[model samples]
Target: MGNDKKSELEQWLEALCSDPFSSILDETVFRVDVFETETEYIVESELINCTKEQIFVTCENDALIIQVHENENINKQRVVHLPFPLLNKNIRAYFTSPILEIHISKEISANHPNRYMITIHEIDL
Candidate 1:
């Protein structure tokens, strides 16, 4: 098999492993990192050149949803699902220039069986 053409599978695999982050974020949503400490979950995101009114955050069914309303036609949405339950009321978010950080308090109590939608949290940039 000297210098023969590569199979379709080989090409697909090569593309899959190359620049994985770019492939993941084909949409307009910003990338984020969510990590857990002993007492809380920290969500870090960077929204450069974005105002406080353009950003929205909420939690539902253990999922943290972030929406950046750019325009009427183009809105970016990102969601992060928590492994364990979190206290919705205790959740807090902060914004300093380009950085948007969210802190969710860890909840070890009984889970809320009902699905509830939280009010849109507008970050103060």
Candidate 2:
């Protein structure tokens, strides 16, 4: 069952990255980090030109921690713990700063493929 879930997640991620919307911000600079543990994985992303835009983070089977920082100051922090097993869950964190930080953690099964993905969308000011 765990392997199946992971496979589904991988497929979803592939499709997401293949989508035309995924490459819409190629001109912008973004940073993505994927960290893996024995039973969990962490994904962190820092996006530029994200002020006044809603940042979305998704995971398959764990909790989400989002922190917003501006000018080296912490603006807002939110943690969401999901109950049910996530096939694909989307959580949005709003930021009004020039720089935005997003962190996501999810449980990873040994039988499942380990991967993380980050997507950014530009919102109208």
Per-candidate TM vs. native?
A: 0.61, 0.33
lDDT of 1 at 73: 42
Scored against the true structure, residue 123 in model 1 reaches a CA lDDT of 53
Poorest stretch of ten by lDDT in candidate 2: 108-117
* Clashes (candidate 2): 0
1-125 in candidate 2: lDDT tens per residue? 56456654455556645756434522333433334445444444555544543454434355454444566665544433334353343323333344443422354223322223335443335
Supply the global lDDT for candidate 2. Answer: 0.43
Residue pairs with clashing backbones, model 1? none
What's the count of clashing pairs in each model shown? 0, 0
Model 1, 6-72: lDDT tens digits are: 7553464355347466347633457676556877768777787877667777777757777778775
